[model samples]
Target: MPRIAEARDAAAPSSTEQHARVGRILEAAAELAAENELERVQMNEVAKSAGVAVATLYRYFPSKTHLFVAVMLDQIDRMREKFARRTRPESSARDAVHDTLLQVVRALLRRPLLSAAMIQSNSMAKAAAVPDTARVDRNFRQLLYDAAGIERVTERDAALLRLLVHSVFGIIQSCLNGRITVPDAESDLRELCDLLLAEWPDSFTPAG
Candidate 1:
């Protein structure tokens, strides 16, 4: 008999069942990564933990990199929802943006192993090879723009935000690598937000 093989496509899930299965796979991968280094994580274990066949897992995630990148995407979605629920209208654009980024940093620090895996995958991903990688960047930018209260984005605003985001990611990588402490990272992020958003309409407000 001819050998059978599953399609090796890491496309986004379409059906409800597929979405649920994908969610389970992400959850399983995240749990495993949290407990061990990325290099130690095994695909077969993730599939067994997720209750999906090995081939099925590969259908959604062609490689460990793709799996973890999707996990980062899932994290972004959760962050957006959390921000919406809190709805801090009292905060200025700079404060909101700073707080949001800090939240992200702290969340990652809480799960160092898993965060390392996700960040490594995200950094390694190429736009052509992992299309969801672009989705991660676009969604994160939108989150920052929303925090900035920028209903309409301008060329200058976009450019500044892009630089600010890149700087923040660098800080995160440094913190993860133990090159900087969390307090220092927090201070650095605050300074960057202040400097980058100085021109933003509501970046600073007079204290009572």
Candidate 2:
């Protein structure tokens, strides 16, 4: 009985250990990418900084694109947790969602280089080729839905949210490319959120 219990504990530790190692790798990659251009940040250097082997890094992140996409997802997870801790009783669901997304945009813009690297990697990735790419989309939408106090998402709601996300991504890219100023990007996002969410129904019966 004691041996069996010990074996169960030993087997369970790998999951925790693996999460820690992956977290280390992500932190290392984020730090290095923030310090330099995307092309210049090497995977082996990330492994060294994370205290993991090069092969280990590649095993988790098949490519730089996968790594940065995972970073974006990590960032979203952090933001979701942060928002979860706050209270905003005064704002409507629409306003809450708008504020949440705007805050996220500002946070990313604050780290321009890192944001650029992650956004570019996300854009270049295909859902079929990179599974994290699809997860990035799903998690981000869930974040917004949660902010809006939405308990369920309909197809129409999902489509509108998808459009909103894509629009925001475009604005971010434009701002990063120097085609738009920060204020302009913020203004556009505000207008977009208002326009889309204004039509967002509180209750809808699914089509037959």
Candidate 3:
């Protein structure tokens, strides 16, 4: 029993250390991306900043695109969790949707460099073509399920929800690019949400 316990404790530290190392790499990559132009960011720089060898960085992340994609996905997941927690059972669907969109837009704005890198990556465009789109749809569907119960959702409603999510992303991108003002972007999102609610109020039950 003593030997078994010792082995378990030793294994636990190895697992924890691996997690800490990966976290350090990710944090270093984020800081570098934020501080420098995305076009100029290189794997060598990331490895150096991460205090890991280039081979180690490659072992963890196959390519720079993969690394950036992981970063964006992590950011999205964090925002999704935040929205899930902030949305309340007693909150009106429209209000919940509005709040969620605002939160996501604010997060993107906060990480402008990362957002820009994502937008600029041709690899991202290719990734978005299929698997990424499906993953995004799944995430949004889950959000919708949280806002409006799953039983109430239909195929048509799901399609509309996907459209709204894409539109919200477009609006945020436009705002970031200066193609639209912040107030205008907010107005557009509010109008879009209102239209969605009007068309499918039945899908979104008013919280009691």
Which candidate number has the best lDDT? 1
lDDT of 2 by residue, 45-162 (tens): 9999999998887777767777888888888888889988988556776777788888999998888888988898888876766677787899999999888877778797899899
Residues 96-166 of candidate 1 have per-residue lDDT tens digits of 89988999889999999999888888887776777778888888988887776777777997899889878
Which pairs clash in the backbone of model 3? none
How would you encode candidate 3's per-residue C-alpha lDDT over 86-114 as one tens digit per residue? 62655556766776777667777777776
Each candidate's lDDT (Cα)?
0.84, 0.81, 0.64
Report the CA-based lDDT of candidate 3 relative to the real structure. Answer: 0.64
Off by over 4 Å in 3: 1-16, 87-89, 128-137, 148-153, 202-208
The candidate 1 region of ten consecutive residues with least summed lDDT is: 1-10
Error of 3 at 54 (Å): 1.8
Stretches > 4 Å off in candidate 1: 1-9, 203-208
lDDT of 2 at 138: 93
TM-score of 1: 0.91
Error of 2 at 196 (Å): 1.5
Pairs of residues at least 3 apart in sequence or in different chains that clash in candidate 2:
none
Error of 3 at 144 (Å): 4.4
